[model samples]
Target: MLLERDNRLEQPDSFYAGLIAAHDGLSLEQSADLNFRLLLILANQIGRHDVLQAAIAAAREGVTA
Candidate 1:
């Protein structure tokens, strides 16, 4: 899910920390669902709508780029 962080890829440590907090006790599906909700909350809290949109667009743009 690094692709979902766009230019913010420079901050993997914080991302992984959040992911770990969100997924520490769940199954794969639960982890995914929780992570999704958590990301939404975080983006909203940070007022980072464009960043999120860019991240999603980047993901669709390609895995290699």
Candidate 2:
């Protein structure tokens, strides 16, 4: 699977809304923990070492740069 920009979600609005709603009423620490847990869960589901590493590097670079 290519890891570039794409519009693959069928229900983007609901998905984004749900994601935002998941963080509702949480402090920064709680929100960060929730996001990390969610990332681990989804990353495990992907289950590809190279893709996961590439994704992690790409995401980390964006923030640090």
Candidate 3:
């Protein structure tokens, strides 16, 4: 399976808003932790190693340290 690159969310704006809202009142550390936990949960749900690797590579495509 391939990592989906297209917008598949039914309510993309709403999902984005909700994701941002989830960090409300969180400290920097807490927000980072929340994001990691969410990523783990979602990755587990999509349990294919190759797909996850593709997603990781895609996410890092234009990112710099």
Candidate 4:
């Protein structure tokens, strides 16, 4: 399956707020850890190597080291 590129959330603002809220009290390292864990959880739900790879490439598009 191809990675979805559209906004699929029922309430995008609320979800964004909640995601930001989740790191409200976290240190930088803790926030990074939270993001890593969240990525793993969502990736597991996706459960497709090709789709995950596509998503990663899409996410990295225009991003520089």
Return whichever of 1 and 2 wins on TM-score: 2
Residue 40's lDDT within candidate 2 is 93
Residues 1-65 of candidate 4 have per-residue lDDT tens digits of 49666889999999999999999989999999999999999999999899999989988996988
Model 4's alpha-carbon lDDT is 0.93
Candidate 1 C-alpha lDDT tens digits along 1-65: 43343465667899778768867879999978886898688778767667677776776778764
Estimate TM-scores for all models.
Answer: 0.51, 0.87, 0.86, 0.87
Q: Candidate 2, overall lDDT?
A: 0.91
lDDT tens readout by residue for model 2, 1-65:
54757887899999999999999999999999999999999999999899888898888988965
Candidate 1: segments with Cα more than 4 A from true spot:
1-15, 63-65
Q: Name every residue pair that clashes in candidate 1.
A: none
Worst 10 residues of 1 by lDDT: 1-10
When 1 and 4 are scored with lDDT, the better candidate is 4
For model 1, state the Cα shift of residue 49 in Å: 4.4
What overall lDDT goes with each candidate model? 0.72, 0.91, 0.93, 0.93
Please give the TM-score that candidate 3 achieves against the real structure: 0.86
Off by over 4 Å in 4: none
Per-residue lDDT of 1-65 in model 3, one digit per residue for the tens?
48666788999999999999999999999999999999999999999999999999988997988
How many collisions between residues are there in candidate 2?
0
Lowest summed lDDT window (length 10), candidate 3: 1-10
